[model samples]
Target: MLDQTIKVELSTTKKQKPNADQLQFGKIFTDHMFIMDYTEGKGWHDPRIVPYQPITLDPSSVVFHYGQTVFEGLKAYVTKEGKVQLFRPEKNMERLNQSNDRMVIPKIDEQFALKALKQLVSIDKDWIPTAEGTSLYIRPFIIATQPFLGVAPSSQYKFMIIMSPVGAYYKEGLNPVKILVENEYVRTVKGGTGTAKTGGNYAASLKAQEISSQKGYSQVLWLDGIEHKYVEEVGSMNIFFKIDGKVVTPELSGSILPGITRDSIIQLLKYWNIPVEERKISIEEIYEAYDKGLLEEAFGTGTAAVISPVGELLWKDRKIVLNNGETGPLSKKLYDTLTGIQYGTVEDPFGWIVTVE
Candidate 1:
């Protein structure tokens, strides 16, 4: 547990808030942010809540050179009863620590970190957007600060949490998206930082993302690094496929992100008594399923989109359309149910909702 209480400092001058109806993703930030520092022997100390502003760092920081950084994303929703709540925030915290461990960064007190997050969210509670499908996005990240040119892990680090009020991730709401299977440029190998929420993994995906965007696809469905045949993940989310009335997703093969939303969907499917499988699923298998008319639906799961239904998938020159290029029934049901629980319109039977008091 964190023995130190977070010091609060309010901003004297606040920036003009954006129109909630016109809010975009990650474009605007809240008034205050939470910050904590870590030293080699001192561990983490001096937790504080201060006005959000520019941060200073040295040119030789390891985070810039060696990419010793990690981050987590979650959201705080404004319930129908005018109360602020969080959906599976502890999972994000736990994942953050997991990322930290993988990146050779120091571990954090998960509960205390959550408490700090709650305090920060409480301070910016008004920033939580109230529009339909709008919510306050929270970003917690850590960066190496040691101003040395060495390639080793930094002894100094800074952990910070920031908030952004955003609307829907996709402008078209829960509509389906077109995706391209990336045969070139592997995201990461099984022994790499693919399982970690680090910047380098995302940085390595920019080229493929640009190519996919130029090809008019919304995202790239990545294949396994070794064989380049098995489906690993989507651009930034976990991929799922519905074949012959059964739901299948790629298992956590140490190279795929273990997504919270993905886990929730699995549980939700099981709760509904639907067959869900997590194992190695190859692209050829998907095409075979399509050939047999068993490919029912496809979607991606992540914190940003929650669930992104796939309408079309292009692997090589062969293009396959799912659900007649419309959102599948199961996809719609999952989205509605997930969002309902998030916005407090549906009953949260799994105790996943955490109210921000």
Candidate 2:
């Protein structure tokens, strides 16, 4: 219905090019945007692509104080043949709806939302970067807009999608990241909104992330809130430890965000006949494996970094370096296979990429 029905608002901008190498992440915006509004009675409506401009929200808006916001991060890439493709966007829409269902926000049709996004991309296809590892980063978010001070979910909301041209996660090359062991500052706990892609979770994490950054750590590896023994995740990304020739990651404990990249990696591992396990993994176990030289490699997976190799883990004063701060064999193999599939360089055995044009 959306594909043939609506005429997109084309608010073009004078193409002012930036130094591709100097592009800071999320610092610039494209010309146009995709927007849709939702009210109490009228569900999602007014879906359109407008000029990128400041959106007005009252200071007392619910999202300002209550933080009832949810978002999804994904990317669209134009292939070497100038064909635009999205990387399994249905997964993002499903996750976005799951976020809506949990937040009590009005559920809109996912197919329609996708159609709107594809049309927006088609209009702004020229903004997509043609450089290596660059992409059109898509951010779809919903925020509570009602002006009530009460504690309940707002009756009004806005669902909007924006695009930004982004350089690769590792512009300095594929370098290993140093993760700090955060004994405190638990990311999400049991019976909490950890599974939801809400803003509060991220807002709660910024302080810890800032502290870690100041202390020369690239990210933080969160521990289980109750015992602080089990490994949870790293920053916003999930962790995978290659132990004993098998892949082991933390099981979904109701506190961990089920990262789309993490799920995809597990599937690809299994498809390649590599041993993979999803279960409880403790800090002690990982440390022991590393000490015994059995820990082949450790990396965090997500949409942002895609795959970040961990060179050293900083637990207070202890520094556990993984073989001289270089990417491991398994890490390279996984990165190559996944990125190859994404960039249309490898055989997409599972048919994950969706062509946009």
Candidate 3:
């Protein structure tokens, strides 16, 4: 429906696709990619699909200097019936626009972007992996292209969609991970670019993540930037805790990224009539609950790892283990139900699945 004029050029020499069993995350790309350009006066134009290759940009591109970039990630699953489907892709597009607004980039038409995604996926549909715990990872991003040296918004930009066949995020697959509570380095602050899905945030987290990795931790549990007391997120994922028969997650207070998976799990919890609350949850409170024997379970949710159970939290030499460092019942159930709906094995009561064909 987007002008019906997108020019697509299939790749003549297709690259050898990776086997599903040996697939890694974001390493193997499909044969083709979707691209669109934008100018200051003339909005977004020249929608096209071409062979996947390197892009040429000037050395003075704003994206390289000022870091004006925003991206979104979603996956396309292959059902048992050999059908391709996207999970709440519109939500990703909506979030991308929100990021664009914050990054000073031009907003793209969501419907058009979705159509482009479907067309691109259809062209490389054979690249979709059907093996267990494997799906096609879709990355849609926008970058400032104006080759200007001044510190201002770019007048030119490029929007692109690329696909990769990826296996599970963790090699262990749905197992609990050890997280180090980060009280020193902060991921983001209030009135900052915390909610936006931009590159600078991830760039800023690399140091803490590297340190935590050296310390034998999977990820860093970031506390609030102001006082470094309240919980914000765990690595790149939003976190949740089960305490005394209730589910609690950090409320969206303009600093945390409103995760789609986080929202879905909250909805699922409420539908099951479980006591769920979205409010400020401090790390000390979680420690207090653990001290009082009320801490039931802990997990993190995101696009990559659907639900990653937190087995241990190490804060200042104090270690709090959840569920005996094993995956909890609630964590397992959520992962199973969400993945079942994604793979078309369970009935989609909430109408969250969208078929490609």
Candidate 4:
């Protein structure tokens, strides 16, 4: 059920207006935050909008030991009307519930979360950046709190929503990035917690990403565990390939995450009459198509980055260049269209825009 006792206490940095340019991707925090706690029998309570501060926890907390936790990411924007808006927060709420189901985190009312978050944002609206490609990043996470030595899920949990100001994914501009195809390590496997937005998945991919970065690549193109031929994803984002004039992406196979940006791209492309296909994309097909000049485009989609074009992919000693080392026409079209809708320039016929005011 939705927690009704809404507490309020503004942060000490309650300024009239924060310098928008000071945001350096989560370096600055907002004046308020949302927090709630849950226990096995008591459920979720103490829904509050309080000052942003550090959270104290027991050293033996289950989350500290076994790492039974889950989290979500979403953003809030400031429209030209000087009012705040969120892009389909209900979807994030549902995704959080799905994560709870997978990790055994207790479920709280989504409406209550929406209410509490809105209150915090309303109180700290000045933190929202007005610059292009800038936003107020919202992160909601739940961690096990009960101190237990057993290897089981904790009975107590803490859910929190912290906000930070972020700038464009690429500070200079939207430049195409090179990706490394990592065949050595698998990010997630079938029947694993790949579909959920839990920390372990990201942790497993960190080593691979670090290796790729150390070798001069921006991200890694992961493959399925069993065959290692099917393309899975790119870092934390979903992958897409435009082959033979048809856009193809790996279908969600329980090991793949269904990103909001990926879904939005599919919908927008279909609306524009673009042939977007969702199927199992094989690495062999991509490499062969690159040789045949059929692979027109490739990109990664996620919340942090709306669309990151893949200019080159290094698989072992062989390098595959996508469409001659630049962003494809279709990739740019989708990026502009999606961003246009988000910034309220074009029509939002799908009813995806949810105004915060």
User: What are the lDDT figures for the candidates, one per model?
Assistant: 0.94, 0.86, 0.94, 0.86
lDDT by residue (18-78, candidate 2, tens digit) is 5667566677877878888888887777777887778999888899888888999998887
Query: Given candidate 1, what's the lDDT at residue 112?
Result: 93
Q: What C-alpha lDDT does candidate 1 achieve relative to the native structure?
A: 0.94
Show the lowest summed lDDT stretch of 10 residues, model 1.
167-176
Q: What does the lDDT come to for candidate 4?
A: 0.86
**Steric clashes per prediction:** 0, 0, 0, 0
**Residue-wise lDDT of candidate 1 within 178-213, one digit each (tens)?**
999999898998999999999999999999999999
lDDT of 4 by residue, 1-357 (tens): 564768897666674444655567666788788898998888898788888889999899999888798888888888777768787788888889898899988886988888777877788778888888788999988999998879988999999999998887766656788999999999989899999989899889989999999999989999999898999999899999988888899999989988889999998888878898889888989999998988899999988888999999998899988878888998888787777777777678999887775
Q: What is the C-alpha RMSD of each candidate to the true structure, in Å?
A: 0.9, 1.4, 1.0, 1.5
- For 101-193, candidate 3 gives per-residue lDDT tens digits of 998999999999999999999999999988887899999999999999999999999999999999976666678999999988999998999
Off by over 4 Å in 2: 1-4
Q: By the lDDT metric, which is better: model 1 or model 4?
A: 1
- The collision pairs in model 1 are none
Provide TM-scores for the models. 0.99, 0.96, 0.98, 0.96
User: Which parts of model 1 are misplaced by more than 4 Å?
Assistant: none
